[model samples]
Target: MGRLPEAPLLLLVVTVSFLTGPDVHAGKILVFPVDGSHWVNMNLLIQNLHAKGHEVTVVRTATSWYVKEHAPHYRSITVTLPQAIVIEEEEFFVNFLMKMLEIKKEGVSPIGFMKFYWEMLNALSNIHQQASRLGVEILENRTLLQSIRDSRFDVVLLDPGLPVGVLVAHELKLPTVFNVRWITSGEGHFVVAPSPTSYVPTSGFAATDKMCFSERVKNMLFYFLNTCIDKLVVCPHYDRLVDKYFGPDVKFYHLLQGADIWLMRVDFVFEFPRPTMPNVAYIGGFQCKPSIPLSPELEEFVQSSGDHGFILMSLGTLVKGLPTEITSEIAAAFAQLPQKVIWRHTGERPGNLGNNTLLVKWMPQNDLLGHPKVKAFVAHGGTNGVYESIYHGVPVIGIPLLFDQFENVLRLEARGAARAVDATALTRQNFLEAVQDVLHNPSYRSNMRRLSALHRDQPLRPLDTAVYWIEFVMRHKGAAHLRTESYKMPWYSYYSVDVCCFLLAVLLILKAAVVGSVWFVCFRLCRRRKPKQE
Candidate 1:
């Protein structure tokens, strides 16, 4: 009885077609994610790609549990682990936390730091060998390699945290994009940009952008040491693996140097000022999403706290199984607060736990942080936890435990949004005071709200930016044009140290010539006056 006008109907049809028709941007994508938190972080980007109609496959390792649980539909090729040498998730985390505690106990003197560094390298070497073996297994499987080749994937996304992804990308002969879950490392930075140690501090040191003389010296030394460790210990293992699986034609270092783009999980708001190349895209809050409604039990618990609000405390997944004594101290601190506490604990319940505190094995951290009833977050200062708290405008009480955590918490502390306490020195009074300071102090909340606004004020959301660049790389085959010429230069040349040396050499040569000419003139004068002198 009633038909729409032809012009309006045509407009509606065109809009519908644009929205629902086959995606012109879709590409076949292959991802190589390191296990645990690295995989969890990459899964967010993977989900976005999948939703955009891109075909994706992830090569899963033994440490991958989150990917299987979260993105079960995405295709995966599991690397089999030998039963004799299998390391369970619980065991791995326990060892990691123990090492962290050891480092905390033994202060970071130069010698002590070197000792710890060697130990870490040894552990990493073991893991690298395991990952290499897995890579070899995958490549040796002719059927799998044939299928992957036949799929003709457009590009490979990799987490360079471990070296497996670099090997896989090279074997496939695909354009590579490195997805790192922390501030870009020296290795990652050198691949696509210049990382000047003069201003750009390494990941772990708690130095600001403007460093004192001592701090800069330490930064330079650490940068050099870390590079040596990577070259001597890490890269050689990867080289052997590449030679074994792919052949000597392609080296691991070459793969890294040729990376098309680096999807770094960092933002200028949170990070100190540093130079980044065009190929280095900062997707800081890519994992952060609009808060989901909390579970019924969590809602009730949080709502019961009234205007006093509650605090959310978690050390993240990798730092579980802390000592019971430490947990007891934390519990005692929480008991002193008027606000209720939601603590994520993996071990046995602390005997001194307060009535207002609730301990759970896991919690939806981001959703709880977004709740109005949540006032402050007590966390281990991991990048993910810090970003989520900042996204929700929740102030933080940071207890830095391990690598990069110290640096992250220090930045937040500098910004007036957080207070940090050393995990080794954490006492009931100190912890309670930190919690009280952030909750009662209006400045912390104000700073956090400002940061949250700044973080959210962007032309495009971080996820969309990440996806656009990912697709851009696929569309262009490789975004090599965006890469800086610095990537191809040696360290000395890139920093102009060679130029300085050449100038010094020229000055020395000129000085020597002047001295010789003066001597010759004095000798000739003496010879001409020799008879009169006699």
Candidate 2:
């Protein structure tokens, strides 16, 4: 019997070896960078993927600095679109519709209807451009796609902001992985684009359920308007393309939902608790990787500061050159601080800078955070900066400008790792108070160090986790199981109360019908009994 089974045994051994062997499924990944944030995030992903033994080719919008920095040695292709096309405009309409649909309690009005009509037309023009750009991206990248298919891409890492990447992901049948560089509303609308924040809930913007009457009504209308755009405009456009290749039954969002992974730049520790889909993985600290050496000027600046130390100030790249009133107040705040203020000011150094204060246009941020003399950080609380500070265990004084800054600061404050100063209502007193609170408070520093330990103490670095999961999705044929199926539920399905209310309404209808029938029967009986007298 043992000798007779030799062939089967050999087959079993071969199957086991094939299943467990190293490099069983070597595959390539297509990376896209449609914006500055995309460029940076994608560049880092490329580096990590390359290090983890995966082949990568980058496709990006032209003139990206990240291409210069990281992907210099790798092959890079640019997305081509006409100048008239704008993606943000489509985003606005998509946002407006979503907000309108989310809050059904507060209905729409005549003025709102008129405003929505104008916005919808404007949004329609944008959608036309977006569809046009997507077509152009396909045409330009046709040869590139052919090459990727020839080489065999197991999965596509797409930037969801751009329609081109999603279109390509669908075309290739490779599992798509989304990398979000900005804070997305739990609903997925980006807050940075020219749209009302009412529909989308991110860290800084207030959630829909919590808004006042007027704002809630306004946002609800916008959400309804956005839902129409998503259905009529975005969904239809995607459906036409997807159905052309994937068959008529396939939906655009369904295909997107089937994506392998969604790596959001968010920390639950820093954000509010909202129900999340399984496929949506929050790898927020990806940008918090330890870095190369600091710039010579920044290193020297830190070294020059004595035992009193320095307070570092910066408002991200976009809003660096702010209004004069704000700058004056910031300067005033610096003038009051006991510590030396090494400001990364993008404008001229004010004549009234404190004796201890020094102004420089730019500094290597991570390097500055790593400096022993850097006592506190004043940042816009951009995800990148917050994580960098957290990575180095430095307390932060947040002056949030817009978007999720408030949320970021709130999270930090809740954790006792930072203090917040509102940029909109900023004054010298508030600025000075925040600075003192961050620098002088031992609790902030202690909590920061504790969180830094938890963040840094991961079995593998965030980059490694990101790269590994991406390849895992590719190797597994598609990590379809990791995707959240919650999208199948309609807008109403998200709320359990809605489901209960629906059941309750059905019960009430049945009860009322039964009671009416009983009453009718009783009346008929009474008429039959008294028929002669009538």
**Considering every candidate listed, which one attains the maximal lDDT?**
1
User: What does candidate 2's lDDT look like per residue over 433-506, in tens digits?
Assistant: 77887777799999999888877766667676677678768778777776656556675774467889989999
- At residue 11, candidate 2 shows an lDDT of 96
List runs of model 1 lying over 4 Å from the truth.
1-23, 69-72, 82-88, 102-118, 182-187, 245-249, 495-502, 511-534
List candidate 2 segments past 4 Å from native: 1-26, 63-65, 69-73, 84-135, 140-144, 181-204, 207-250, 290-297, 348-351, 457-460, 484-513, 520-534
Per residue, candidate 1 scores C-alpha lDDT tens digits across 374-483 of 99999989889999998999999998876778888999998999999777777899888888888889999999999999999989898888888888888888897987
lDDT of 2: 0.66
RMSD of each: 3.5, 8.7
lDDT (C-alpha, whole model) for all candidates: 0.80, 0.66
Provide the lDDT at 378 for model 2.
Answer: 89
